[model samples]
Target: MLRDLSRPIETGMPTYPGDPDVTLAPDATHGADGYATSRFRTGTHAGTHVDAPRHTLPEGEAIDERDVGEFAFDARLVDLRPLEQREAIAPEALPDPGAIDDDVDLLLLRTGWASHWGSDRYRDHPYLTAATAERCRAADVGVGLDAFGPDPTPTARGDTESPASDGDEPDGTPAHDVLLGDSLPIVENLCGLDDLPTRFRLYAFPLRLRGGDGSPVRAAAEWDD
Candidate 1:
């Protein structure tokens, strides 16, 4: 059986401060007189979204070329609920890098922070450290997270502090520098990961928007017997 871990984006769904709030303006509705139609203007990274390599790499491949087959492979979920604020996920947090078979590709990090999937809890959640990103890059693990961003903090001056000085670094340099510089694609804002077995088959496919920086995805994974 397959379980979906993606979060839904709704009219009052949590979003970054400056990002547009999700709103529905009904053009026509069955209740009024006809079929329903609406308009949505939200951030590309809103909700459970996938970040293309181009999102960080200056010349990296767009989301279109990233094959869905790549995601439909062996996977494992690492729990990180023990981590406290500002604590980075290091090599020790991972299973024996060599113990994982060559076929494994998808590496899902479940911080258990999804309990606060939205709201301020979504901001400055635990993050992958530089070493963690580097190791994943070396291991060739298709890394994704159930947090806001790979960076525990924001890169811009006022971004992280906007949520009221949660001790997050004002400059989200280290996290982004490693993940983006390595051309790693990060999937964020995932939920219900705790419901899936640690080992499973994942099938996450992003939009094929030609030359586009990134696109939202309906990512899913299946459990084994």
Candidate 2:
């Protein structure tokens, strides 16, 4: 069976604050004696999508440079729904690191955040901690989230409890640095992973936009007996 692990891209879909709002305005229709058509305008990260390394890294490669084949593979799911903190995803919350096979290409974190996807809960959602990032590095796996970003803070942190400046860094850098620096791609703002089998074949491909920082992806998974 195949399941869509992506959220519907519509005017109502939740997006990051200050990001462009998704709009669907009809430009032509049969009633107007024209072919059916609609116009779309939104940020590249609007709905369920991937964040190319270039999105966070200063000199990282874009999506086009990353092979499309890299996006399809078998992955294991780790449910992090029990966590309530907005800070880093603690190492203890993770499953047996050895349980994840070195051959598995992606690690999908199944946090039931999609239920609050459109409300205030969506903002400041829990995310992967720096330590967790290091663990992923040792495990050699990419990470995917059902939330907006991998970090709980919009900016970098100073101490464990507070942001550099009033608990807010001028520009977010730690979380992005953790992955992009390691050449491990990240997929964020996904949905429906909570409804699929924990271990399945996942195929998520983005548009072939040459040198594009990021592109929307149609993420899905296949399961069988």
The 0-to-1 C-alpha lDDT of every candidate, in the order given, reads 0.69, 0.75
Off by over 4 Å in 1: 31-33, 155-170, 173-177, 180-183
TM-score of 1: 0.84
Model 2, runs deviating above 4 Å = 153-171
lDDT of each residue in 17-75, candidate 2, tens digit only: 66788988888898886578899987888788887888878698888998878888678
Specify the poorest-scoring 10-residue window by lDDT in model 2: 155-164
Q: RMSD of candidate 1 to the true fold?
A: 3.3
Task: For model 2, state the Cα shift of residue 193 in Å.
Answer: 2.6
Q: Could you tell me the lDDT of residue 75 within candidate 1?
A: 79
Give the winner by TM-score: 2
